[model samples]
Target: MAQRVFITAGAGGIGKVIAETYAAQGAQVYVCDQDHRALESLRDGITGSCVDVTDEAALDDWLQAGLAVLGGCDVLINNAGIAGQADPVEALDLAQWKKCLAVNLDAQMITCRAIAPVMKRQKSGAIINLSSTSGLFGAPFRAPYAAAKWAVIGFTKTIATELGPYGIRCNAICPGAVSGDRMDRVLAAEAQARGVTPQDVFEDYASGSSLRRFAEPEEIAQLCVYLSSDAAKFVSGQAIAVDGNTETYHSV
Candidate 1:
């Protein structure tokens, strides 16, 4: 049987690549994102709905619809996240902080809650939660994002233990400075917060990694595929980093 995979925020950015990668591997892929246009742009073999993860009812509807189409989910990738505010903690807005946690942390739990029973019945499944290198260390100007990502690692581990007895695996992927429009926007925000040029911030970020460069979205996407495959059947409760070994997150 073709593996049935579902992804969150899979309409664009890194999530789109992950979805496409699974589809290429002959998996039945279903994704949800808030961007209607981006969802429309998805290629053949991949299907998605425009959904805001923060809206529980809407998210549930998307998941139910996907479950109906795919029959059962063999893999779930919680890839929806935002960089949140690029400012000091004291300077952050309350609403923005809540929104960050809502998307990055809460939505993962929501999806897991809905899918756990289905996986339990089958006695086999894989769950990959997207974390960040920031979750492993301090991200100077991105407090909310860092906090939520850190929580993701803990959540991943906890669920791994809870689901292990039933043959379900859960893991967290911590990517660092992935090269793309998203990273460009993140660098731009950090630059504005630190009163420096985006190029300078970009250089600083690249230098922080031992590889001296950012990771490509394909790199992260490939890891997602691996973690859900039979090859990684024994890998669970691991917070693997796709980050070229980050050394620091210093500002320019």
Candidate 2:
């Protein structure tokens, strides 16, 4: 039987690549994102939907509907998240923090809460969360994102511990600066905040990593796909960093 995989924030970037990777591996893949048009543009092999994970009802309904169609989810990639406005905590908007937590942390919890029972019944499953290098270290001007990602790491471990006996494995993928539009946006934001050119921001982050280059979205997606597969059946409760040695740099 083809493995049934469900992924959040799968319209583009790492999420989209993850969906494609699994689908190519003969899994039935369903992907959801808030951008309807972008979701539609994804290849036909994926089951795509426009979903705002922050809306509990909508997320639940979408998941239920997807489960019904896909027969039961064997794997879930919780990739929906937001990098809110960059600002110091003292000047940060509370709403921005709340929103960041809503999508990054709370939404993943909700999805896990809703799906764990199904996996428990099946007695086998894997959950791959999209955390960040920031989760393992402090990131200036991104307190909320960092906090929520840290929460995701903790959440993955909790689930892994609780569900380990049930054969449900949970793990997080902490990616370093992924190269793409998201990187461009982050670079632009950093440039604005630090009064440097985007090129300088990119150079600084690249230099921080031992590889001296940003990771491709496909590279991150490949790790996620592997974690969700039977190959990683023994792996659980771990936060694996695909960071190219940036862990050495504690700075944001």
Candidate 3:
């Protein structure tokens, strides 16, 4: 049987690639994104909808509807997140902090909560969370994002422990500077704050990793697939990094 895979924020960036990858692998994929136009553009193989995960009611409705169509969800990828602003913690906006947590961290809880019973009934499931390198170490100017991601690691472990006996495996993918438009924007912001060009900031990020390059979204997608497969059946409560081997979250 084709795996029923549900991914959050799959309209673009990493999520989009993940959705396409899973679909290509013959998984019955369902993706939800905030961008309606992007959702419309998804390949015919994918089932998609415009959904803002920060809205609990909307998220629940979408998940419930997709579960009905897919019959039951075998895997879930919590891929929705925002970088927030490039500012010191003291200078960060209160509203932005809340927004960052709303999507990056809290929304995953909502999705997991909804999917728990279904997976429990079936006695098997896999959950892959999109955490960040920031979760493992200090992210100077990106405190809000860092905090939420670190929280995700703890949350992932909790789910793994609680759901392990039921055959539900949970893990986190902590990606380093992913090469894309999103990274470009992040570099631009960091560049402005540090009085350097975006290219310089980009170089700094790449240098922080041993491979000295950005990780491709397709690579991350592959990791997601591996973790959800039978091969990784024993893998749970692990925070795996798909970075070019991220040496540090800090630029230095």
Candidate 4:
């Protein structure tokens, strides 16, 4: 049977690849994104919806429609997130901080809360929450993003325990410096803040990883695929880092 998958931010980046990968594996993938263009760009195999995950009403509406079309859901990839305001703790914008938490942390919880009963009824499901290396290690100037990710780990663990009895598995994937447009933007911001070149910032980030390179989006997607499959049936309540064994994110 093809699995039903609900993925947040499936229009681009890591989320896009994960949706595509799952669809390729014969899963019924439903993706939602705020970017209409990106949503439209998604391949025909996956269902796409325009939505902002931070909004509970919008998310609920999207979920209702997608699950209706999908029949039921077997997996959820809480892949939506933002880089947030890049600034020191003292200089951080309160509004941006709140918005970051609202989208990255609170939204994931809301998503699980809405879908718990559905998965529980099914008697089997998996939840893969996207976290970050920053969650494991403190990220300088990206406290809000880090904080929200850290909370996700705790959130995933708690849900794994709560939903375990119902046969629902919950886990987190932590990626470090994923390559693409988002990383470019982050490096640009870090460069501008430190009065250095983007390349310098990139090198600093890569140096922390044992592989000394940013992970390809597909790399993260593969992990999601495995976690959602029976291949990882016993994996739950764990935070797995897809990073290249990143030692730190504080260099430079």
Highest lDDT against the true fold, candidate: 1
lDDT of 2 at 193: 90
For model 1, residues 1-252, the per-residue Cα lDDT tens digits are: 999999999989999999999899899999999999999999888998989999999999999999998889999999999878878878999999999999999999999999999999999999999998888888788889999999999999999999999999999999887888877887888799999999998888788879999889999999988999889999999999987887876421
Kindly give the stretch of ten consecutive residues in candidate 1 with the minimal lDDT sum. 243-252
Candidate 3 ranges beyond 4 A from true positions = 191-197
| The 10-residue segment with the lowest total lDDT in model 4 | 243-252
Per-candidate TM-scores read 0.94, 0.94, 0.95, 0.94
Q: What is the C-alpha RMSD of each candidate to the true structure, in Å?
A: 1.9, 1.7, 1.7, 1.8
Error of 3 at 233 (Å): 0.6
- For residue 71, give model 1's deviation from the true position in Å: 0.9
Report the CA-based lDDT of candidate 4 relative to the real structure.
0.89
Query: Compared with the true structure, what per-residue lDDT tens digits does model 3 show for residues 1-252?
Result: 999999999989999999999999889999999998998899978999888899999999999999999999999999999876668877999999999999999999999999999999999999999998888888888888899999999999999999999999999999887888888877888799899999898887788789998999999999999999999999999999877877656621
Q: In model 2, which regions exceed 4 Å deviation?
A: 192-197, 247-252
- List, residue by residue over 1-252, the lDDT tens digit for candidate 4: 999999999989889999999988888899999999998888878989889888899999998898788878899999999878778999988899999999899889888988899999998999999998878988778889889999999999999999999999999999887888978887998799999999998888888888998899999999998998889999999999978987766521
Candidate with better lDDT, 2 vs 4: 4
TM-score of 2: 0.94
TM-score, candidate number 4: 0.94
Which residue runs does candidate 1 get wrong by more than 4 Å?
188-199, 250-252
**Model 2 C-alpha lDDT per residue in residues 92-161, reported as the tens digit of each score:** 8989889999999998988898889999999999998888898998888788889999999999999999
